[model samples]
Target: MKFSLFITGSPTSTKACHSALDFALALMRGGDHSLAGVFFYEDATYIANQFAMPPRDECHIGQEWADFATQYEIPLYVCIAAAIRRGIVNDSEAKRYELDTSNLAKPYQLEGLGTLISLSSESDRIVRFR
Candidate 1:
């Protein structure tokens, strides 16, 4: 089976986000199961913020998500509108907005709601973390 993912919770504030990551890892490890992509929406867009810096004692959840996506070669998509609202801009968006810097990093790309819909349509299952 193939699966698509949607996260609607803050990485640090909710255990559901971590559970989702663990579930994704398990699904990918299981035979013949593939992941289509992970879409971060609402407060979950913070998971794609490249500039986030957690204290040494705390888990850097954003980096953890990025690393997981990189290791698994999974596409990580952050809702563009939500990202902008949260100040998580990419290089192009920063240029477009004439901002001094951008906080979006690799493995997580800005995408519209259409991407989520497309992934959901293409996958056998849609897992949501909220």
Candidate 2:
């Protein structure tokens, strides 16, 4: 089976991100399931913020997500509107907005809700974490 993940909780303020990661790991290890994609919406868009710096003793959830996506070749999509509203922008967006820097991390693409719909349509199920 193929599964898509929809996450909508703040990475720093909630366990949703970690829980999603755990679930994804399990799915991959199961050998019978695959991930179609991961959509970060609402507050979850913060997980793509490249400038985030958690304390040394804390887990860098953003980096963990990035690494997982890189290792598994899983598509990570962040809602463009939500990301921009939260001050998370890619290089092009930063240039378009005349911002000095871009803070969107790699492995996470800024996309619209249509991408999520597409992922959902292509997956057997959508597991939401919030």
Backbone Cα, N, C clashes tallied per candidate: 0, 0
Per-residue error at 97 for model 1, in Å?
Answer: 1.1
For this target, which candidate reaches the highest lDDT against the unseen true structure? 2
* Tens digits of lDDT, candidate 2, 1-130: 9999999999988999999999999999889999999999999999999889999898999999999999999999999999999999999999999999999999899999999999989999999999
| lDDT by residue (tens digit), candidate 1, 46-82 | 8888777889898877777788999989999999999
Find the candidate with the highest TM-score and give its number.
2
Instruction: Give candidate 1's whole-model lDDT.
Output: 0.90
- All models: lDDT? 0.90, 0.96
* Global lDDT of model 2: 0.96
